[model samples]
Target: MRALVLLACLSVSCLAQRPQPCTSPALMTGDLYVSTQSEKLTAFAKYMYDALGKRIRLREVGSYNNKTFELDVLLLYRQGVVYKINHKNSTCCKKRLCTKFHPLEIPENASLLGQSVLGSSSGPGQGLLVNNWYGDLQMKKGTAKYLSQVTEFGCVPVSVLYHTDQSGWVVTSFYNNVIGLTDPQMLYPPPFCQDARLEDEDGEDPETFFSLF
Candidate 1:
């Protein structure tokens, strides 16, 4: 009878204990979307903030030959970060496009750049360029090389610069003169980018990141 009583007490004590509970659920944390230096081009700015390891979809508000198309970018966060200390740059464009030299305008129907900067003054975000009329991209240093063009809205002194070679376009947005990057493929976010909008989210440093599988 005593053994039975002790067993009963032990059973009760075991029942009183509870399994360990999860302290917290894994969550993705990032800053809320904020306006970058350029007011007209905030979408790209917002993208830089939310694009880490996620996908990006872009739709030009205007119509092209009555045919509207959307651009998709898959952002991969990387390890290295672009921290800009201080930089200065000046951009200029010819009223007449140098398109004859640079025929590589992304989204052929999209004319969001005529000419612009190639790299960002600070941050992985490329610098600014002067654009006008149709957004056709022209190389910096008056070269005849056309890269990519960005067609967002903003009248800030400088324009965003999007460029690529064999890879796809690397979009850059500016806020308060700050620069960031947004690449759907998780391109190498420049290590010294200041703009939060242009950094690659999926693969901040692709090599450092490992897959669970």
Candidate 2:
């Protein structure tokens, strides 16, 4: 009887520990700090989610080694706007690039629900399994695509398992990333160029964030 009771208690504890989504939309607007590490490199990301007006503004600043990248996206459900800035300052000469994309298109079935913003969990395993999906634009090729996956645990996002795509797969884990919201932006693109805007004349680049690492 004690063993059965302990098993029930453990099951309840496990369910309670699973990451839960914010029940309130107001709670969804904040900053998410995500850090990732691979065999050869590490990346840190700061994501700002603002539920402002009738649109959602998502800004991301990612860094690895000497390369830094920024993404500013305004989402209006099925359509949105995007701005990308990538800068590198090292012995390879300082280069800053900015690309502007207006009326950015989203997939017909794009959605952001059941995503973990501020949560954590522990289990009787080496790591957790998770899934993720997001729309990303290729900085160099000026392309965009929806990358979806059901792989392993990692935090750029704590988990992205609410999407409708099931064909993508990858494995990842978090080095150190936090889930939360922020008001003032933390990281931003460097101030070197003023009007370095370019239209999306070359079409969208076919690069997903998952494919990079």
Candidate 3:
């Protein structure tokens, strides 16, 4: 009886350590910061995301090649359209969205690295508990490996790192101030994009941009 009990306890411990799938809130609004290790590009954006409705919108300010620019990106999966608007010049480029909407969720096949506290654990509510997960994602041209950290309780994304053959060594995104979506209209394209010019077939690929989310 003692040996049987020990074995049962071990089984439970193993099961408890297994990685569990987690999904973000269906509708969320947050601030996103993106950086690339191989490029001198960095962006900060306020974003609205609707995982269930397949819509996303971002108002971003980014610096690249010593140039600063403000841009807006709107992705509507149902309409299969992506609008990239330059806020500085009031130019908009409408492009066909090639990729499907991928929700911000820990993939089922992701391996949990472990869990850690982001701050002091000495007092209650002093720190945030986060889970780390790693996985390889199959992309159109190559496989991209990713590491993600999210809040343990609500599965809110804290940060994500991706390495892809085309995208160089590393691209990381940090999420902050995530909350449930407040305004539904935030997901819609701006009025200035109504007369946006359609991008050429061989123009900037939307697939590479959408994969970040």
Candidate 4:
């Protein structure tokens, strides 16, 4: 009976230390930087607190179709509610979207990228674990230059930079093929907010965008 009791206690302790699912944008707030190794993509966010509520302003830039693609996103979290305003500009189009949703909809792996940061300490619940599943990968001869564009392309190195308690800031990089797939809500906002958008000349041909993918 004593051994059984000890086992139960140990199980409870492990459960308590498990990294909890990220149900709050607050976990992702503050100053954060995310980027790809090739420097083709980069994002920065600054969260500030004031009398009204906590607001996170974000800016991201990348290259598409040999042109620059940029996004400005503003997230407001108040009273357990999340509100978002995002503007995107690229060679294909310019879009502005707004939406409101519950934080519970966000997956734990969405913003818990700190886990893959290189040289970061890990304990019972420091970072969440994610799996990358791939199947049916095909390649053609003389297509070596286009491998990076393949949806199931080779793995790439990604890094997440964050502020630490003792240290000023730290960076960690890891291999990822499906980086943001876990965050569907974040990748594409609600459809209602997608109306009245502006399309660039190249937007007419979506294939031009997918060809690179």
Candidate 5:
């Protein structure tokens, strides 16, 4: 009787656990802070989630030592903002538990600060508007422009919201070159938009996709 009970206990211990999705859309978000090792991108995906395993999921997209690439980072996110803190080989996200998060501190000014204000425009806009670049690629051409900016003393353009008043971010992508911003709010995230492995413009999914970025 003891042996039979022990065998059953072992079987239960080996069972796999399933991940669940958010039960509601209550504006979910994450904070991130990252570190890198010799070009090795580990904390690449800095989005946080519930300890219960439902907030974020990672799928290997592709790689790059040099060159522009794309990926499939399908995240059904519902939250405030994803702060890509720091730069270069690292990007730290901010969730409730992140240690580096700090509130903005700015002096209040009422006198003339040499600023121009204009009424908001209502119309369709152009350019990319995604946040949290995921997927995979070993770019021989571009670097983690955003992280690299803070890493190597360069500036990276990060999209605040997908041109909307709020929707948070759509995707984080990379472009071969930099884009200009008229409204800080309309700026594009460092690189341009990227497609996922399965969502590549060519629509080709590698037989075996592995991520080392």
Candidate 6:
């Protein structure tokens, strides 16, 4: 009886120690590595996020249309505008940003998969402990789902796998070297973008568009 009682106590203790869902910081800067399976494209970018101000910026270098390209994308949700600047031609295009701000956070309805160490845990402070969570994204169009791995302590996003019927199932993003937003100006559109021509809106759903990246 005593042995059984001890096992029950241990099980309860483990359950109590499980980490809960969490939200990320309001201001953050990081490197984003993205892979799109359908396009056969891989991109490396520096990202700036301001959840409080509903702004995001990405400076990306990748291959597009069989050519190497460098682009800067600025999303200003509050102003409902997006700026896409092509470095090779020094041209910018302005489009309507239909999506709302979506933070790097674990949804409250997400199911906790498990807890594990990202690296070797045999030594002290040698590995990061993370929580894996999976959930379906609530979208207005096609089906969407996501799996996220975040740090157990600060809930800092480590990686995410997002899928949608329109875009296919093989988009992955890795986030690293993250820190608090260093410069507020990084979120603003560059001076050259002021003369950007407005493009015709494609009538894409806001939720579907945001989930692509």
lDDT of every model, 2 decimals: 0.28, 0.36, 0.77, 0.32, 0.24, 0.76
Query: Which order, best to worst by lDDT?
Result: 3, 6, 2, 4, 1, 5
Question: Which of the two, 3 or 5, has more TM-score?
Answer: 3
lDDT of 5 by residue, 1-213 (tens): 999999998877765221111122212232222223222222223222221322232222333333323322322223322222223433333332112211111112211112111223243343332212222212222322221111011212222111111211122322232222123321222232222112113332221111111
Candidate 6: tens digits of C-alpha lDDT, residues 139-162: 655557888888998888888877
The window of 10 residues in a row where model 4 has the poorest summed lDDT is 143-152
Model 5 gets an lDDT of: 0.24
The digit string of per-residue lDDT tens for model 2 on 1-213 reads: 999999999999998765432221321334433333231222333334333332334445555344565544333322332334444431111122233322212233444323322224564554545533456534333343444332233223343211112223222332233334444332222354234443544533222232231
In angstroms, the error of model 4 at 33 is 5.7
Q: Give per-model TM-scores.
A: 0.18, 0.31, 0.83, 0.32, 0.18, 0.82
Q: Give a tens-digit lDDT track for model 3, residues 1-213.
A: 999999999999999866587998888887877767756567788888898889988777787656776767788999988888776676778998777788888999999899999988999999989999999987666788988898888888888888777656555555665567777877777688887777766633322234454
Q: Is candidate 4 or candidate 5 better by lDDT?
A: 4
Alpha-carbon deviation at 30 in model 2, angstroms: 7.9
For model 6, the stretches where C-alpha displacement exceeds 4 angstroms are 1-16, 87-90, 195-197, 202-213
Task: Show pairs that collide, candidate 4.
Answer: 117-172, 118-172
Highest-lDDT candidate: 3
Total clashes in model 5, counting residue pairs 3 or more apart in sequence or in different chains: 41
- Point out where model 4 deviates above 4 Å: 24-56, 69-98, 102-117, 120-213
Which residue runs of candidate 1 sit more than 4 Å off their true CA positions?
A: 1-60, 70-72, 75-157, 160-213
Q: Residue 190 of model 1: what lDDT?
A: 34
Quick one: best TM-score, which candidate?
Answer: 3
Summarize candidate 4's per-residue lDDT along 61-122 as a digit string, tens digits. Answer: 54433456554443443432222344333222233223222221123333222223223337
